[model samples]
Target: MSGLRLEPVTFAQACAFVDEQHRHHRAPRGHKFSIGAAQGERLVGVAIVGRPVARHYDTGRALEVTRVATDGTRNACSTLLSAAWRAGRALGYERMITYTRSDEDGASLRAAGWEPVAVRPPRRGWSCPSRPRAGGEVEQVGRTLWQAPGSAQAPS
Candidate 1:
């Protein structure tokens, strides 16, 4: 193995990463994963996963992915997705899922094992968590969006 490592992000780190994403002009609604790809002291990529409601489809849990970026030269999609997968699994989720616009190119997700179950635009009027980040600057993610892994579906 070429020495690849993944780490779980703390709430503080998650807030910082989400702030960075917001600075970069991306939506920071769902960002629970917050993984970093580093070789020693250098960070090569970032991947974040969050649990949201599966309202888009009639079934399955919504595991949203955000800020999946790599150093162009290195293929980081697999590493990132794998980290998110492990996190989701650790959280007790049985299956993983994501969403993308109908016209958007989701090659990275496809390459990383995220299958597109729907092509519809995300629903309007998302609700955020009642409690915000401790700091007035950072906002906490929505609570209603996510469900415990085993709780979403009963054994079939």
Candidate 2:
């Protein structure tokens, strides 16, 4: 096992890391909590967890990992994800979820024991006729939704 360790991370710090390192998505606007993975004094990765993005799942009992960024450190992503779930569970959360682009392999999520439960199709963008908002630089790609501790609420 790696000497990767988990520590509390401020939302700002976590967001900064994600902004600098994430392949596509920008940092999230807000988060409920954040965790960092470190090998000694250096931060190797970060995870930001917040209320579920999907209205249907935003029941105050579920949390979503909005961002995760790693400096290519081994096991850093896996460690941070595991800690994120543990922290959520400790806070009495009933479910934890996160989404990965369709192109991602999700090896770290799988290593952290999260299972893919759904595949969400891509939309044109966040902006539509109802609300006129700026389109993001990142393309709207299909995403895989993953949940921790398996398929308790998963559909057949």
Candidate 3:
């Protein structure tokens, strides 16, 4: 498997890679994923999959793919996400869900067998940053409340 390179990304690494992906794709935070694509030592693309957001549909045990993007000429989102799906399945996730702007080139996602399940209406509200103190350090951490739709308070 040396020829195939896909791996889990740290939160900081995911932030950086997602920033690069969003720079081109304009993906929103709710669609955040945690995988990176690389060719040898060079980074190429990223794919993110997590639970559905409160503003979106519920994907129970269904991973919601937030964004996928490539750098330069290397198109690696498919490979990365395929690996992620396999990993997700291994971890007991049953399905994957995703949303893309109608104008975005999401053919790779379609080709990878993700079909549109719901369309998000245009957003209109201002969102605030959520930062809390941890061990006396200010940290930007996701609130584990029932944030996602159809979610209950579960221990993290």
TM-score per candidate, chains pooled:
0.56, 0.90, 0.63
lDDT of each: 0.52, 0.87, 0.56
Judged by lDDT against the true structure, how good is candidate 2?
Answer: 0.87
lDDT of 2 by residue, 77-112 (tens): 888888888888889988899999999999999999
Candidate 1 lDDT for residue 83: 72
Backbone N/Cα/C clashes per model: 2, 0, 3
Q: Which ten residues in a row have the lowest lDDT in candidate 3?
A: 142-151
lDDT of 3 by residue, 42-130 (tens): 76777767676543345466665666666743447667656667766767766555555545555565555544444545543334345
For TM-score, candidate 1 versus 2, the one ahead is 2
Query: Which RMSD does model 1 reach against the true structure?
Result: 7.8
After superposing candidate 3 on the true structure, give the runs of residues whose Cα lies further than 4 Å from its correct spot: 1-4, 24-33, 55-60, 126-156
Best by TM-score: 2
Error in Å for residue 18 of model 2: 0.9
Q: Is 1 or 3 the stronger prediction by lDDT?
A: 3
